[model samples]
Target: MDINIERLKSTLMELSKFGYREDDKGIYRPGFSEADFAARKWLMSIAEQEGFITRMDGVGNVIIEYHAEDVAPDTPAVMIGSHLDSVPAGGMFDGTLGVIAGLECIRTLKAQNIKLAKPIWVIGTSEEEGRFGGMIGAQALTGKLTPHQILTSHDPDGIMLSDAMRSQGLEPMEALSARLNPNLIDSFFELHIEQGPVLDQTGVQIGVVEGISGVFKWIVKLIGKADHAGTAPMEMRSDAFMGLADFAYQINRIIAEDGTDTTRITVGKAELKPGFAHTIAGEVDFTIVARDMDETVMENLAASCRKALSAIARKHKLMFEYEQVSWLTPMKCTPSIVEFIAQQAQKLKLNYQVMPSGAGHDSQFFTDITDTGLIFIPSINGISHAPDEWSHWHDVQAGTELLYQCVLTKAVNKN
Candidate 1:
């Protein structure tokens, strides 16, 4: 049975109201905020009303399940979902699509009076946008969270993760108890809007993601002598901005020498000390975020960046320093699961591609614990985490259909 696209659209429209800002028309459900919790409760409320088993985990993940009467109580479940929380002003489809799509899958099965060999669970994960430097919900569920991380994590506003949980009447340490027994889950599936332009630009209707790229972040500093802009001779000045500029220019060269087609380097943030147009920048502080599918390539890219900055600093007669902030190793989807998804796509006669996701998702955490598959629908113009991000409704229908097929094949004893 195919998912009801109209029903899916209606549920998604209802969900968009929780954190919708009329001024900018963006969703504002950042992790652990009132809007975020409200959205979670709403999912639970609606699922319970519909006679589905539902609960919220300690870390605020919303779990909605459908268990056929014939299925044994202890049977492993097929879990499918994406994050519930969104980036500030994020689009409607980014994370919620997977959760709602899974919900629709359950609705379709029930509507068709289908019995299952396994139960199905749809989860809305928490803090996946990484407000506290981690995918808290998925990590907790996968037993990847630690007490130290729970205590130390904080938002950009300096609100501790513990405090955030406390404000919502949840004990911080309870997050550690949220881990799922790996045996209880048969596999995990996630359907998400490609927050990038790849699928859309290539005219592909479906993306069978092979893996999520690894990432590294560095905070770099360049120090030089400050002087009046007019008095400092152009040839003799130790200009920190010059050093930073030179490094920026070498990024392409570094990628060409040490990176592959999937490598990405971005200078997302930067600041010039003693800010004034009339003063030479004595110090430049910036961040370097690099991503690649392979750990070895990531290492080479990191080394290339360090070497380039050092040479640029020496040429400008400046001192350079950098701190490695964080590193996440690449996660590959289970090979069998990836191939299974591709086979399903071919069955549907859809235009599909095997691709790599440049962005992170909750599915990555499930890779080590269970067979995991991530599917992508295109974002219009590849825009996401913004007010204007969108995916066509038809594409959404196609994706949910594929998800339903996969879940059906895995969870049912017979059609």
Candidate 2:
């Protein structure tokens, strides 16, 4: 209630304009795209208009800061923000909500004329949709991203990550040095949508995130000789498609039998080469993505995929190989910060629960550099990264208020 709900809505509306789509009502703000840069400029303009300092790091991460007149320059800042880019035809609330909610927190603090010992910074990160297979901004900020990864990565469409950064007037190597001083940021807080059914299904308003799932991805290929569909005998032909089918069936069995219920396996992309109505397919390129809250589970899932696919290739007389594209270990939220969020939800008398995130987030990377925590509001049907992905206005308001309270709790010096 103390937070400005109207301002929150208006900010989100403004950001949405940068990449609005009329077809499916989704957004297409791909990282380092012109629209994404426009959104970054819009955020900086707002910061400047509000008398806040603004800067864009080498990796295209946007930072807007509010400095107390008496605070020491060496004092660590408390940060609240999320990424600005979205997936192709992605929803509005996925990444933009956290950044907007953070801006509103700054506005609310200014309205009350409160000054903390430390600074408040709102960050708009880049490339967080795994376009390059990992979050570049947060990892760059903590100096965790390697030069090899940044230079060689590409999107599903075959767009080079380095080229994208170069087009935006940024250098990928410079991003490697985008590390923040360890003493400069004391803690980080991110308020995001649950992007799952747990909260909405259980009728909970607030979710104090306990951990984020680890993500492992592989790019696999199955190779075989194309043969005439009419001439090749069914028993004698070495079919590439058959190998793919066998892998798919065994993946299900692997997870159901060897993996836990929380484990997930997805073959989200597949391409068939030399398509012909009567010709047998010669080759296949597909991606494998597995997720779980435990790294061991993710490792086991990868092992299972390799073993099953290798056997299928041998049995079907096809060739198979895979590349481990990327890996992110699960991260646990800071205990004190998690407790702070719970206390605020209790104070507000809002229904809440402690939960783990099923998706990867920037908060997971922040854990390496500083104390980090996450706040989640319910998604309407546990849907995200799509046109219909939505969160209720009431839930948004409650989550923003909780974010405001949590920031104030650590931002003010106790001396």
By lDDT, the best candidate is 1
TM-score of each: 0.88, 0.95
* lDDT of model 1 at position 258: 99
Question: What is the C-alpha local distance difference test score of each model?
Answer: 0.90, 0.88
Query: Against the correct fold, how does model 2 do in TM-score?
Result: 0.95
Residue 176 of model 2, lDDT score: 77
Best by TM-score: 2
Question: Where in model 1 is the C-alpha error above 4 Å?
Answer: 156-158, 219-246, 271-286, 309-325
What C-alpha lDDT, on a 0 to 100 scale, does residue 174 get in candidate 1? 93
Task: Give candidate 1's error at residue 92 in angstroms.
Answer: 1.6
Local error of candidate 2 at 292, Å? 1.0
